[model samples]
Target chain A: MFNLFDLGKIFEISSRSVKYVFILFIIVLTIGLTESLFLSPEDYKQSHSVRIMYVHVPAAWMALGIFAVIAFLSFGTFIFKNKNFSLISKSLAPSGFIFNIIALITGSIWGKPTWGTWWAWDARITSMLILALFYLMYLLSWRIITNKNSANKISSLIAIVGAINLPIIKFSVNWWNTLHQGPSLKIMGDTTIHSSMIIPLAIMTAAFALFSLLIFLMKFNTEMIRIKSKGLDRL
Target chain B: MVKKVKLRIAFLLALILSIILSLFLILQSLEKDVVFFLSPTDIKNLEEIEKKKIRVGGMVKDKSVSINSNKINFIVTDFKNEINVSYSGSVPNLFSENKGVVAEGFLQDRSYFKAVKILAKHDENYMPPEVKEALGDK
Candidate 1:
């Protein structure tokens, strides 16, 4: 079935988007960091330490968003059973894992001075660790399982099942009494965080989202190349 | 087509079963590790202290706090009820009267709590939502 899923057009689009987003990501991230460090108002209580929110919140948001994307892509794998969906899901794993790690590390660091402890077995922290495990499992399945078809199905299944953690992580603070504060911005209600902090936060979150897309495109390009080389063998 | 349908059923069955089993384990661990916070009223409502660690959060009642050589004593109240809390170590910078505080340790009784650690939030204008709901316009 020489099914090259519109190879030339996809390559052209991904390449162009990757270049555009990478430039945007760098410029936006620099501005976000500069403002976070210098321009944002010092919190009346934590003072300089409260600035950690700019880094921690955006990383946490990206971690959750990227995992949701993986689950969506995995769902696509099952319905379409298309190799392209599987490839995209696999491509997403590394960046998601890195973002998850960033969230955990920054969270721990931020917790020490504010919460008076480095970490606690609170619902929010525990659920996030489970998410990191899911990311690790999805990535490891790709490397350890030799057969490409079986690996694709297995990793997709892992992603699909691992989606169970997403909702738990989102509501962990609300559902249980945890030290981690309730979300700064509620879906419906007024934002509790100050607008000064929100500006840097919005900019930082955008930068992380763009960076995630750039990394996924780069990884997807490599996966496409691998497929093309293997297809050549069949010819 | 019948064979493919049977295979799909088997696959889905396995997936559902494993998910249920994993969920059971995750919840079991959560129960074991979950440290729930209770307000002063909940403390009054409890039959007895279980000796297992628990967290108590509320506003520190005004003038109910006393400091002495690294040891601090305070009353955490939800307007309608209160509990006396004692701690030997440092408290968070925000841990003062009229501020929101969460103390983790054993309850000596319904009226007395011994805190091993004290956590104070940095949000000057904020209280833990649970504390706010429990206190209710107090």
Candidate 2:
């Protein structure tokens, strides 16, 4: 089982790739941390506590990003009937749900200090919660349906329908008056954030992307190995 | 083969379109949903305050809580300082006296808060950190 690839060659290649990606991840994390923690001045309104935005904002961004990827994967599986695409998408669901959970938790934590409450039914918050729920339902759909074709078809439909929530989540605050504050980094007529803050945020966002990529790749590889092993066992 | 190709192309197109649309929406929402957390003390010092929306956090002072139908009145205190909060809405499961609470709304005439929403602490130990920092200790 372990003798499929040249051991030394595989080790050398994997280690090299891992090192490069890890270094890049570190650099992005450092920039994000430095900008958010040190370089960016305290908000005129929120002061130092506003720094939590660095973490909260990126997590929220990645949550949606991962969902979008999953939705696409689901679509691919539905159209092409590719088992690999479905497996990859299914693998991503748990991670996407985890990120969504993190985003909601961090948002609530940030809300406690800023909004004075832990949660609100404000459009954005409510919609994000719905997004998380949808991800969970998609994951559960796989468990309930043993037939691969049926499971893929149903979950793909769920993913597509749930995609509706993404737009609602984005525009919720604007459509209705909400307690959640408007954008800080970008604005229509004016930008309130300092350059120092933006730099770190960009870095952190990149770091988060890398981190997510690493996780997805590892999960994909593990699934591939499992499938291969099962095939070998049948032989 | 043609049918499969069409499906693949359609899926790819949908994927690209949805991704672009989602990114646009995420960017747009960030403009409004992102904001800073504030303590009760910070809410007090504003001179030109009007209908600006904000959040307030503190422990619900014991015995100061009053309920009349759907309307509820509670005093949030940081042991040394306190603010009166009046809210009329569906309360969360964790709201109670001697626990941390955060109310969202605007200050009315520099004295009372006309809260449109309220959030209760989910646990015993989890007060908003900003509240703890503002209150100094405990």
Candidate 3:
């Protein structure tokens, strides 16, 4: 099975794609910024402050999406006994953590004028805070643990356990009457948001996704380089 | 290697299961308290209204807001029920008639509330001012 995922081949492919991903990310980001910040119409009620949603919503979606990816990868590491899965999880964490913090901060800033408070212990807000803490714990486990195998075991365990909070975070608004408004864009049903705004939001989300992927590839390449320099065939 | 893998699997399963169990117990206990605020209807149905400060959320009834000097008075309604909220402080910019709002303060009675804070709650709909104007909203 190890023969299926050759580290050198994976490293070669990822390293080569980094430059192209970087270029694509820059192009998409510029378009996203223009659409979100300028082209997107001001919210009828919120006025200009609603532009922050372009960054805040995408950052939040990325944060949640990346964490879900990490959890699945971590689970794979255990079942397949694949160190590569752990390595991919490790590379994905920093970008996820960064987006999580971005989401929280942007949310706080948006909350001030809209919700009339900079911070509220509403279920949605508090659950997101807990998710950030869980991200911190997952990242810290890798840094604090000295043994590679132990770190892999502990971090994967942490991710799987923390995943229970994912559903909790998603349903927090519905389950509890929080200060945060209900979801505007429903996956299965009709969306309340106007298409003019939704187009920009979609572009921004794509740009953020590309940005996270760029970060993952760069970080993964660096890890591969480090392993190669250490004269190790596998993690 | 196989033994070590099995041990890791068992260990991981135990941790995941225990965490889920504990979280479930915690959330179950905290369920009632977890709601950010009660609706006007929720308050009306309560068996006993406590003296402790609480939050009630609902839409501000249209043409129901009144002001006298520095204090503001408004009626919060959940369509089925309504409560009069009186506050001495300023309200959020978004606070308006026919808009969602949450008031935190003491419930004076079943029909009256003395509020300390008024937080405006906006709905999820978003569009430009022009679009709203074109839609014939005055």
Candidate 2 structure, TM-score to reference:
0.60
Writing each residue's lDDT as its tens digit, candidate 2 over B15-134 gives: 667876885687477743442234556556656666778767677899998999999999887676678889997776557788667687888755588788887643312123444466
How much is A100 displaced in model 3, in angstroms?
A: 0.6
Listed in order, the DockQ scores are: 0.30, 0.06, 0.75
In model 3, state the lDDT of residue B55.
95
Candidate ordering by lDDT (highest first) = 3, 1, 2
What tens-digit string does per-residue lDDT give for candidate 2 at A61-101?
88888888888877666676655567667767776787788
- Alpha carbon deviation, residue A227, candidate 2 (Å): 1.7
| Model 2 segments more than 4 A misplaced | A1-19, A185-190, A232-235, B1-138
lDDT of 3 by residue, B1-138 (tens): 778878877887888888889988988898768988999999998788869989999999999999999999999999999999999978888999999999999998898999998898989889888888988755
* Ten contiguous residues with the weakest lDDT in model 2 chain B: B121-130
Alpha-carbon lDDT, every model: 0.81, 0.70, 0.90
2 or 3, greater by lDDT:
3
Q: Tens digit of lDDT per residue, candidate 1, span A1-235?
A: 2257677688778877888888899999999999889988777566788788888889988999889999888866654566667777788889989999999999999988887778877888988999999999999998999887778778888888888789888988777767777787888988877677789989999988888889999998877666677772121
**Candidate number with the higher DockQ (2 or 3):** 3
Which residue pairs come into collision in candidate 1?
A: none
Docking quality band of candidate 3, CAPRI definitions: medium
